[model samples]
Target: MSNFNIFLKQGTCSYCNNSIVIQRKHSGENLCPECFQKNIEKNIYKTISKYEMLKSKDRIIVALSGGKDSISLLYNLNIIQNRTHNSKPIIALIIDEGIKEYREKSIKKAKEFCNKYNIEYKIISFKDKIGKTLDEIINMKRETPDYKYACNYCATIRRRLLNDGAKELGGNILAMGHNLTDFAETYLMNILYKRLDIIANQYFFKEENDEINQFYIKKISPLIRIPEEEIFLYANIKKLDYYPSHCPYREKDPIIRKRVLDFIQECKKYSPEIEFNLLNGFLELSKTLYYHRKKKNHSLCQKCGYPCGNGKICSYCSYLLEFS
Candidate 1:
């Protein structure tokens, strides 16, 4: 052997002595992989307990995008339930936007994970429900006057689809895998667009309203506190298999949403806790927003019978009528 000394790549937990390949920068722990997992799981448990997101018998339908954040959430929730044998079992709900190549791969991964966990998996396609796929919506919008951003149509339709799909599948609680970055971006977007009503409703928790309760599924975000970077890191650390590409339309959106996110990320170099601060601001403003939305609930949409403002038809009904 050569007379050279090599530094041991000591894979040891910063938090504990358990071996780990990764380390959490914020927590400053050389934690064993399991301990790192536990750290994130603790956040999920805290959120659930704080918000009371789930009830004993409430059927939960998770919005799994075949991404690491969602996979992590499903895995954690499963582990929690397995530990407690808690109220009702969880299911995964994936809405196919009908992006053949993108969705084909993602949906495959989603189904694979769901099957492995033995969790019930349900896929609702835009074509089946909306009579047109996302591609159709994009093309239609592109041709129309007063065109909306691509994300605008995609998000709106997807939101409606998620609510309806959850309801159709007997899902009282719809868990979304929106991480901290997503939440901050949404908050900033609302501020930019001056959509106070949406801002008010952006809180992680919400009290039920009769009109909304009638048509909408109760949505929750267990990954609300986890940073996007952390989720990406965790997924890589755990060797989680997920679709890696972004939606092609995302880059083409005319809106400033992505720019805002980029700014936030750049600011994070100077202050990593900026997202947390924004989250706090959102929570503080949400109470005022809740009262505002409740007061703003006006007439019902005549077309679909859902609540609508000054319009003859609700946004959902109008989009359907116009598109189909």
Candidate 2:
């Protein structure tokens, strides 16, 4: 037999002397199922501690979409909160964007998970808060001459709604489920677009004023160090009840973000550590940009009184106006 076949025949887990389940190419570790799951949890815990993402008194609102990443994050954070001394129970906040077949299925899975764990959860929809569902919004704007992609509208509205909803629920921190690949894609997109201001805004150690905190909850991503594929693996390995489909819009949209994501995924085949490198670059570059860039005083949106970044209207409001 060949050396490759021989190596596979003798492949035991690097962590435990058990049969290997998966080999992480980037780290060159052969891991059994149990050790792999444990390592993921430990890495999440370490990331939380390293970034000071949580405080004992802080109320956390997890952005749950019933997908693999969010479900995995909620599962881990639930365990952590239960063990912590005085942390408030994390709340799962689901955004119902009103996509007919898509959002309904995901929301069902989200509710089931929350019910199983007896976690407090809330559902807010674009229809109730923004006067129209995402589908309706798309139907209205799809034919407009200046129409943008569905993802752009969905992201802007979802972000504002999440922040407002979390604040309304008295949460001081909002935990997101974005993974390393997500961050890398976003970082590369912003770099390509030369959106340095956006990069600076992502600085983890940026000072928080009470005014900004009132409108925007402190956001953290405990899963930022994990990759998208690994989260998918962990979720499946743990038998998590997560939705196994991507948003239909994401699949069908002709957005540049999709191209950027494709580029990153393609690069990963050649460079296993490319995502981690981009993440590190984002961390350092964001910090440097945050400190060195000239501070632009935030101006409140005339309609909503939230910071508009020296503009008279925030992107959320501008989109709403366009929809009108």
CA lDDT for candidate 1: 0.78
RMSD of 2: 3.7
Clashes of 1: 3
TM for every model, in the order presented, reads 0.89, 0.95
Put down candidate 1 lDDT per residue, 1-25, tens digits, no spaces: 0221122236787677766745444
For candidate 2, what is the TM-score? 0.95
Write model 2 residue lDDT over 1-324, tens digit each, in one string: 011121232478997798866778789998887888899999999999998888888899999999989999999999999998977999999999999899999999999999999999999999998899989998998888878878989999999999999998899999999999898999999999999888998888878777777788899999999988778778877999998887888878788988998899889889999999998898999999998873667779999888886679999999888877
Off by over 4 Å in 1: 1-14, 17-32
Question: What lDDT is reached at residue 291 by model 1?
Answer: 71
- 208: Cα error in model 2, Å: 2.8
Estimate the lDDT of model 2. Answer: 0.88
Error of 1 at 4 (Å): 33
